[model samples]
Target: MFYDVRRIESYSLKISIENGRVEKVKFDESRGKAFRVLKNGFWGYFVGDVDDREGIYLAEKNAIGKGDVNVLNVSSGGKFTLKPKEDFRDVSVEEKVEFLRDVEKNLKGDKIVSTSVTYFENVRRFSYYDSNGNEVFYEIPRIGLIVSAVAKDRTLQFYSKRIMKPAGLEALKGAYDIANEVVDVVTKLVNANAPPSGDMNVVADSSLAGVFIHEAFGHAVEGDHVLQGASVLANKLGQKVADESVNIYDDPTLREFGFYPFDDEGVKAEKRTIVENGILKDFLHSRETALKFNSKAGNSRAEGLKFPIVRMSNTYLDRGQYKFDELLEIAKDGVYLVGSRGGETNPATGYFQFNAQYGYLIEGGELTEMIRDVSLSGYTLEILKNIKIGCELEFDPGFCGKVDQLVPVSDGSPHILIKALVGGS
Candidate 1:
């Protein structure tokens, strides 16, 4: 039997400013412990208040038997701490609220119906011990600022800017510039025409490309999805999945919002190249899934005491040779999609659809007119095969949800050119 104990200590603060006024300020602190026992092929888990001894007892008592499976050996253990330039705890709630309020002030315009600014920070401490003589501890801190502007004329238009990273309050130092950009984009979107609906070459900004990589391609390469036969990439390792310029990696070591020195499963966090030069290389893996796939374990993650599962960290498409202007020129007659509201993907079928918050028509290698209500839809493999990757890489931080669990993650890419179906209202 194998057993492990995990303790998570978390602190968070949030400030919301709406319409140039402080709307809400909240702070929370929580501590929890989870214990897991591996018996036969079954996992017995228990989560409760931060009492490690009790959690261990309960987890052992709950052990069950299925068949048998062996996990890859990962015995390295140590203590790691991330020292932020500025500690988030040192910044008072009032200061955070005031900063957001100032950012909100810069987002006001006559056509703007409402503006909201939110600042959030989280610090998490993780400690782990296992029966195999392994112990580890680490601390991670993250902060983010989100600014939203809604403009109303004949209809409503909204635009938002997000700045999230694995830093402290210093990450929000440039909040005003992002606020101004959001206001300008929303103002233009308020009067922009709907894009023409059809299939065409398209250029995606870094943010949209990030979401596309995360939702379209990333999930399909998850080992858990492959085990369940719910991924198109299952059984397709070493095959060509994208253009040779396409290189993708999920690196937990990167100092992005998804940075983690060690996974919850006591596995040392390391970078996994999921795709390299268009060939399917590897899948993200937890201990169990790693065992099943005869691979190494590292991608396992959890939120507080929730059960650990395979999850992506800082996933991104590697930068290519083409610059942003070069990509636009390559897509000479297509639309330039910018920013992502949200999107959905079916890992099994590789079908994906995502909305670009706003876009611009490209004419003669230049951005021509603003467009709104645009959605991009296509099969993941098809888009990847048609992709022309760009040189400037950028990352966007957010939360990823799977199996009812939410975890911080960062996804990124440079400008990418592709041909896909574009839908417009």
Candidate 2:
């Protein structure tokens, strides 16, 4: 048998604060060892927590007979570079904590009944090799700061707009913007009222619209789901999916949370268009799925130590021809939904549910009353076709969860004016 080896390691630190007291601090490191041994087109895989060279080799040899030895048909991978401005390895935990503490203190306000803040930092290093002599190596650092706020009512709440980014400590510097947004939303919620129910022309803020595209449309474009006959977009390539002004992309090549030199499968990632000028372009794919569907692998990925799966990195809508105010100017009576509290979707059924932190009634093309508990639910295909206009673009960062696994992702679009259906009690 011939074997190929890969090296993987992760360093992580987390600090949580609540009620002006230090809550918890966690530090850990993980090193993974894996061997790819091939015999007669069959692959024998072995993975463990040990890093000793001898242990890794022995584990590969010993596991040859335990599981199904099926060789994975993979694509050719080559050298690539994803440079970091500052590496997390050069920073200390105490330094990270001090920055987070400052954020907590800065956000403390009279209307802020309580505050909880969390800081997370991680660095991943890995290298992989193939029998074909292809090699890929990567070093990436990520940082996250999340602040949760409660108003005097205790029930009125919201979360920070800042999410983890694929950068170093410098990424955490401008977090006061997020903290201020959270404070504003929570305070408004304490005094806001529910929007009156009606058929409405709506403007979805960039962050909320980004979540709409990701949870509602992006997942529908993963090739695996299409192959499984579980996606609403299945077999819809070359057809119109939205307004001619709508152009959505999954571009890992762009600088965002999902950027990577190469996917976990060691394949070079590429920018892909899922929708262009209202037409369906293509679906995201891994090598196997791409082969099965006669397409290119768009670098759909998963975490290390696990086999790679089809996933989106930085999915976003391209900016449109209109500005945000212009969209509102066209709608005399409507509501504008802003920000997001995440959302849920069934890509197969095209059904989705998304909650906005707050909304404002627009009267005479001007912002008016504030509304609370705004949730939008509908079929993905139906609502997308109803998009009247697209606004300029912006990004909202967060973690995307799939099958209980969390991966960093960013979603955004400019404000979108839509004739949408929303419901709440």
lDDT of 2 by residue, 246-328 (tens): 88999887778877777766677778888999999999887657877777875656566765578899999898877778888
What's the residue-level lDDT of 339 in candidate 2?
A: 82
Q: Which has the greatest lDDT?
A: 1
Clash pairs for candidate 2? 392-414
Clashes of each: 0, 1
Per-prediction TM-score = 0.97, 0.90
Q: What TM-score would you give candidate 2 relative to the actual structure?
A: 0.90
Compared with the true structure, what per-residue lDDT tens digits does model 1 show for residues 70-101?
A: 56667869999988899978877777776777
The lDDT for every candidate, in the order shown, is: 0.88, 0.77
Q: How many Å off is the CA of 46 in candidate 1?
A: 0.9
Q: Report lDDT (Cα) of residue 406, candidate 2.
A: 73
